[model samples]
Target chain A: EAGVAQSPRYKIIEKRQSVAFWCNPISGHATLYWYQQILGQGPKLLIQFQNNGVVDDSQLPKDRFSAERLKGVDSTLKIQPAKLEDSAVYLCASTLRSGRVYNEQFFGPGTRLTVL
Target chain B: AQSVTQLDSQVPVFEEAPVELRCNYSSSVSVYLFWYVQYPNQGLQLLLKYLSGSTLVESINGFEAEFNKSQTSFHLRKPSVHISDTAEYFCAVSTANAGGTSYGKLTFGQGTILTVHP
Candidate 1:
């Protein structure tokens, strides 16, 4: 089975510029997530989508970041007016369901964003 | 709120040597714990998890972690490390009562970089 797929394995943008990353989750997966991993830190959940509907986005920076899963299959995360602090890898992951049961999540290689 | 902390930011060990990576968590309620490994330029992969039963959990890769409720710690250990074991490891936690909607949403600690030198 194919794993989660993400585009532009690496990206470079200047501060104040906008950047966008794309993700296509595993087939038949019902839950999708976006996470930001800064250097030396574990991934921080930015947002979660349950079949196109947002489940959680409390940690997302609404002022600068936005994400959407149009068909609940592929997803896109955008950052406008990027700052140096936003330089980090953006990972996308998926799971089979949106239930309480323990399920393994498959992750993409992630899009490494470097804001200069 | 739940939070996890990995005490060691980096650990260097010779191949075939025993190693331990310590983790601690703070939560007012019961939580499910997990360990994830990430090789270079790769995404995080589940190593093992601790839910309700069995304080000790082992991964297929020969890595094991013991959930110590009394000490509020879950430390990953391996009897003999391999060069392949070199990677970044993360400890995570999720509230048991988070329910279906928020069930798998995890709070992760700063990662520990394990370097196994051959």
Candidate 2:
């Protein structure tokens, strides 16, 4: 099966600018996740969706970051007025179930964002 | 609340040498453990996971991790690694249960970069 897909493999922007990243998870997968990975660090979960409903968004910066999974499928993440610290890779992943024991997550190639 | 810690930020080793990457996790509830590998310019791929039963799990590519409940550690190890094994590895934890409560949201550790040279 094809893996999770993402667009805009790389992006460069200035601080205070806005940028968006898109993700298309594996067909039929019900759970989707967005993560931010800074240089030399592990990916941090930003948001999670089960179908079209948000399951978690505690780590998301409500001031400048937003994400949506429409129709329970494809999703997008936006960082508005980006900060210098916003420079990182945005990753998307999908899983067959929201349960921890059911299935493993499949990930996309990720969008690398650089802010000046 | 949950958190994961990887003590080593970078580990360099020669081919055919043994290596270990240490990981510790803190969680109030029962949690599932996982190891993920990220290749250059790519996203993370699941290396292995520990849910229940055995405290040991092995990945296809000659990697194994032992889950030590007492130590609260899940350390990845390889007896002899190849150059292709070079990559960044992450350890993550999430509640064992699913649905509205846990959402299976993963909390990841600071990654460990393993560089294998010839």
Candidate 3:
């Protein structure tokens, strides 16, 4: 089976510029997530969606970051006015379950965003 | 809330030698623990997981981890290392909320880089 897919494996942008990342989850997957991984650090959860509705986004920076999964199959994460601190790899993951279960998540290659 | 801690930032060991990577977590309620391996320019893949029952879990690639509820630790181990096993290993934890809303969100550690020398 095919795993999660992401676009623009690498990206570069100037500070204060806007950038967007795309994610297409595994087939039949019901849950999708977005994470940020800084160099030398593990990925941190940014937002989560169950189908077309958001499940959690408490850790996301509301002022600069936003994400949406309109049709529940694909999702997009956007960062406006990017800062140097936002330079990191953005990973997308998906799972088959929407409720409590021991489901494993499948991750994508990630989009490495470098803000100069 | 949950958090994970990886004691070692990097570990170097010769091939065919036994190795251990330490991990500790903090959470008030019960949690599901997992270990993920990330190769160069690749996404993280699940190595193993510990949910309930057995404290020990093994991955298909000869990696194993033991979950210790008393100490709140889950350490990954291998009887003998291989060069191909060199990668960044991450420990993560997630708790199921009382509302049965398991968003499957994970809290990951800083990660440990394992370098295997032939």
The number of the candidate with the highest TM-score is 3
Q: Which portions of model 2 show Cα errors greater than 4 Å? A: A98-102, B97-102
Candidate 2 lDDT for residue B114: 96
Chain A TM per candidate, in order of listing: 0.97, 0.96, 0.97
Q: Report clashes for each candidate as comma-separated counts.
A: 0, 0, 0
Residue A97 in candidate 2, Cα distance off native in Å: 1.2
Q: Supply the DockQ value of model 1.
A: 0.66
Q: 1 or 2, which is superior by DockQ? A: 1
TM-score winner between candidates 1 and 3:
3
Which DockQ values do the candidates obtain, in the order shown?
A: 0.66, 0.58, 0.71
lDDT of 1 by residue, B11-115 (tens): 999999999999999954577888999988668899999876899999998999998988889999999999999999999887666342336788899999999
Find the 10 residues in a row with the least total lDDT in model 1 chain A. Answer: A96-105
How big is the positional error of residue B112 in model 2, measured in Å on the Cα after superposition? 0.8
TM-score of chain B of 2: 0.92
Best by DockQ: 3
